[model samples]
Target: MTSKNLLTALLPLVSDLSRELPERERYRRLLEAMRALLPCDAAALLRLDGEWLVPLAVDGLSDDTLGRRFKVSEHPRFEVLLRSPEPTRFASDSALPDPYDGLIEGFHHHLEVHDCLGCPLFIDERPWGLLTLDALDPLRFDSIELDALQAFASLAAATVNVADRIERLALRAEDEHQRAEVYRQASGQQSKELIGQSKPHKRLVEEINLVGGSDLTVLITGQTGVGKELVAQAIHAASPRAHKPMISLNCAALPDALVESELFGHVRGAFTGALSDRRGKFELADGGTLFLDEVGELSLTVQAKLLRVLQSGQLQRLGSDQEHQVDVRLIAATNRDLAEEVRSGRYRADFYHRLSVYPLQVPPLRERGKDVLLLSGYFLEQNRSHMGLGSLRLSADAQAALLAYDWPGNVRELEHLIGRSALKALGQHRERPRILTLSAADLDLPSPSTAQENPASQLQTASSVAVAVGDLRQATDRYQRQIIEACLTRHQQNWAGAARELGLDRANLSRLARRLGLK
Candidate 1:
């Protein structure tokens, strides 16, 4: 690359520093400029969050690449680049396994031998992240001028610094720093983040940011397995009370008798099972946020009690006359249509009104377009790490199957499918392969036509069994047994997948299976 061409690429980034651009766009243009100057097959800009290198933007890599988190310890090339002061280019035959193996866009094969070049971006003498370039040819950067690349690295650092400054100015400096620290801690613990680039996901994020700083009661409504709980975590993480506890309670997981006690605590003698005085989710989350999953499952009586606390900011423990004052920000999520429940007199209208003060509707997975590929990548990486595999990826046909099928069970279903597919695919090989590629056959998702036919086929089977069973109760039990058996067989006896397929909670499905003598 000529110095003149390098200057041309750097100039655009330098000018972009002053232009107000979205953080993702700025980094995207930076990678675009890098590729233009160096003429590499792929380039990525990653931010160092604790021990993980998170892709902020990418060019010439798969869309799912953005969702992956690369640990510096696992990738030797990344470790060397971060430790070095200047740009480092690995030799073509370098023994270090390429992290980008099977990840380059339009490349279906593992990158056995390829050129890799990277430079660490530093801000205020502290390493911020990395700028990396890769090429299919071995000597792509051998004749390239190192000084030009070094100069461009400095420009990249400036671009990142500008983006950080703009964001800090938008939010409180201390709060933003705290949030970043929380994210770093979460990264170190391998916490799953809400990862996506679709417009719907972006909109949901925007809404989270908009309402997160306040103490608004946010009601998140979505289909089951659509990640409503993750959304609640994100809101709490972004809130002013992030340093405090964010307690969670799943209303549906508990019985009606226990829901009230869980929400408002219970004295030692409150009920037969109440052995000791304990704090409730509200008191436990004092000065923080309280997330109620499946809030719609709460009975009308409990809903009225919950509304009183929301209105008065005080709660009385079960069997206790004294009321306890507590401050808590409420964030509730439900897959049910609470408004319909209220109309049906099953849910309290006033409590429903209070909870919907800020309603956020999480979009289902099918509407997210190609985001399935990105999510698949995230799950694949997780399974790869768990299985101690070099790399795990989806083939073109697997990607097509993921996109074609309607994600009736949403993100949870996708996550389970990917993990199952990876394990099944691995078992097919006598020896472990360096790159485990999941084909459409391994995924085992029904074709669009087959999926359409399944419901009708199931109904037909149910009708045939109804004639053999004498009573309505007997017929219902027989139908349920058949459906559960079919789902279990389809998912290879994976209870989680079977539960998701039947649109029932795993625990509930297990209980039903046991009752039906199928367990």
Candidate 2:
């Protein structure tokens, strides 16, 4: 890389700083220019997020590599690069493991990276992240000039700084420092973010931003496993009270007797199990957001009490006359249709109206298009870290199968399927391979043709059983019991998996099973 070549690469990025390109595109161009100027097999740009380095763009790495979060402490090579001020190069035979081994694009066989070089990017004299290059051939970067690499790193910093300014301007309502603090707090709590690029996902995000700054109660609705809870968290994270705690409760997880006690708390000896005074979820989230999952599961009596608290901001604990006032932003989620429940008199109409002040509907996985692949990448990386695999990827056929499936169980089912498939694929090998690939067969999803026919076949079978039973209530119970038993057997008695497959909350399923005498 000569001075003239370096100027050519640097000039485009400098020009890009004023062009108003998308953030990802800007980073992509940066990596492209770097790989072209430096002549490396693979190159990546990662942003520093606390202790983890998250990839922003890649030039020659596998698609799944973008979803991976590299912890600074776990990757010695990344740690060394971040610690150094100047460009650093590692020996071809360095003892430290290469984070990109078996992850280079277009390589089916396991290939270890032989040469590596990296430069730490800084902005305003503060470490931002790192720019790294890897090559399969030994001594590939030996002839590279450190001066050229350092110049590129400076340009990269300027690029990211511009992008950050644009984003801050977009979020002009919130102070940059305060937003950073909120993100830091959120990361410490290990909260999962909503990740998708589809139009529906983008629209949902727009709604969240539009209403998040307000104090309106949000009612999130969608099918089971569609990530309504995640939507609730995102809304809270975007709110004015982000620095405060965001407490969560599953309304369907507890019985009716304990539901009221759990919401407003209890005094000593309030009930048989109430031996000591305890604070409820409302008190715990007084100054912040309170997330109620499965809110539709609350009984009519509990709904009335909850409605009173929301209306007055005052709640009285069980068996206590003392009233406590709280300022809490309520965010509730449910898969059931609350409007229908209101019409049927199963839910309080006033409460339903209050919760839907700002409604957000999460899209199911099947409707999210290519987002399934992106989510698969996210889950695959998680499994890779947990199982200690060098690299895990999906084959082309596997990607097609994922896109073709109906995803009746939605995101949660996809998550479980990925983990289960990875484990099954691993077990098939006599010894652990450096790079594990999950093929279509490994996924074991029904073919598109078969998937289309399954619903009709199932309905026909149910009809036969209903006719045989000869009574509406008895037929319904028998059908439900049979389906539950089959699902349980298929999952080998894993209640959580069975619940996901049946599109029911685990607690609700358990209660139903007990009612049906299957427990």
Candidate 3:
């Protein structure tokens, strides 16, 4: 290409960097321009994320390639790109496997590339990532202008820095708004003191006291609706950063596509329907605490990015390249067995280890015993206040029902039940009663003694039932799954405990659970 034509092609990219386009779009156009200058069949821009190269933009790779995280230790070609200061090319028959093998457009399952060229990108003399170009023609880049490619790479780096700065400015305002909202939420939750005098409750409080003073990451594990979020609030209230806001996000509540953007913020137009740049929970919780509920539900891709932020306290927004330092004490909660998830390759082991630095298992309601009455009273009062009644109390039969029935749904269920029963009891009276009283009939609990029996009531019933000859295998599998799942729940999803109870190896049980889809 002539110098005049090269300048004309480069002018468009230069003008785009200054335009109000999304960081992702800017990178996409930049990658396209680099390909135009070098004339390659494929081109991609990857950002350095610790030991991994995360694809930011690609012009000729599979759609899944954008979501794939490449570890440098696993891909030698990526390491070569990082080590070299200038542009580097590889031999057509090089033994090193290509990272984009079979992913390059129009290259139908091709494992070997005819020609490959890569230029490392740097900002302020620090290695950022690399820009790569690939072609099927053996001599496609044999005589390309190395200096011109280097100049374009420099321009790309400058564009990334500028976009990053612009995004930071937009995120600042959003972060302040989030901080205020969290403060309001924390204020409302301040009076919700943990209510229980049981041994398990006492032990939990002691554990919280010991761990709260430190800056370690916390993983609160329990069944769904078991007040795991309450425990998180207690920890944050006792921590040094308690004065600052405590931001919370439910990983399971969001779709896989938005999890990363919600946790790490995103620039305007980063993806479809992103009309404006928004700050993520991590940035909003800077200098405070971040509580991630149902964290095990996060996809492996988002888990990898989360691990990076926890380890380094630095994060780049979804579309921006600028890394911002945040000081956040993370508190994560999940009902699922993350260890089992890791064993089954559903969750990353490294991220699991990082999050479980201080593990706290919240006791289920069945184990809390008499604490049920105390919580019943609390919820009764809450309903009374909302209904503008003078007071509310439970009848003797209702108290027995509350204690006898095992709360599979935990605290949340208890709260809802009380509210529902109060309305039902009140509606039964023609005139306003002096003090609304909820009875066993009003509570209407299911088999008050079922769940508290052996944790295997359902499984035992299944095993006793007769099955046809051909359906025996299916029935037996269901029985086994029930037994294993019951044991896991009885042991708080502890593999070692479950293994001991079931007389099976821990690894073997994990493998079985995976096969049974229990994980």
Best model number under lDDT: 1
10 residues in a row with least lDDT, candidate 1:
446-455
Question: Each prediction's TM-score against the native?
Answer: 0.83, 0.82, 0.52
lDDT of 3 at 6: 77
Which stretches in model 2 have alpha-carbon errors above 4 Å?
A: 173-188, 447-519
Q: What does candidate 2's lDDT look like per residue over 1-519, in tens digits?
A: 668888988888888989888888889999998988899999999988778788889888877677677767878899999999999999887878788887677876666648899999998999999999999888888889999999999999999999888877886533634753685576575546687876678889888877888899999998999989888877777788777788899999999999998899999999998999999999999999999999999998998999999999999999999999999999999999999999999998998999999888887776666778878888887888788887788876687788777788999999999999999999999998777889899999865432223567877867887888788678878878888887776455868656765667899999999999998
Q: List the residue pairs that clash in candidate 1.
A: none
Candidate 1 stretches with Cα past 4 Å from truth are 171-174, 180-192, 446-519
Please, what are the lDDT tens digits per residue for candidate 3 over residues 1-519?
678867977899889877898777888889888877888888999888566676778897644356455657767888988999998889998877676655565444334547888989998899989899988887898778888888888898988877767765854423433444455466664234577766678889888867877899999999988899989988886676767988999988999998898899999988998889899999999999999999988988888889899989999988898898999999999999999999999999999999999999998887776778767756765576577554466655676688777688988899899999999899998987545667799999753544334547765666565344347667777777877877677667767656755667879999988988898
Return the number of clashes found in candidate 1: 0
- Residue 423 local lDDT, model 3: 93
Candidate 3 or 2, higher lDDT: 2
**Tens-place lDDT digits, model 1, residues 9-115:** 88889899999999988988988888888889999999997788998898998877887888788888899999999999998999888888888889998889999
lDDT of 2: 0.85
What ranges in model 3 sit over 4 Å off?
1-190, 446-519
Q: Which ten residues in a row have the lowest lDDT in candidate 2?
A: 446-455
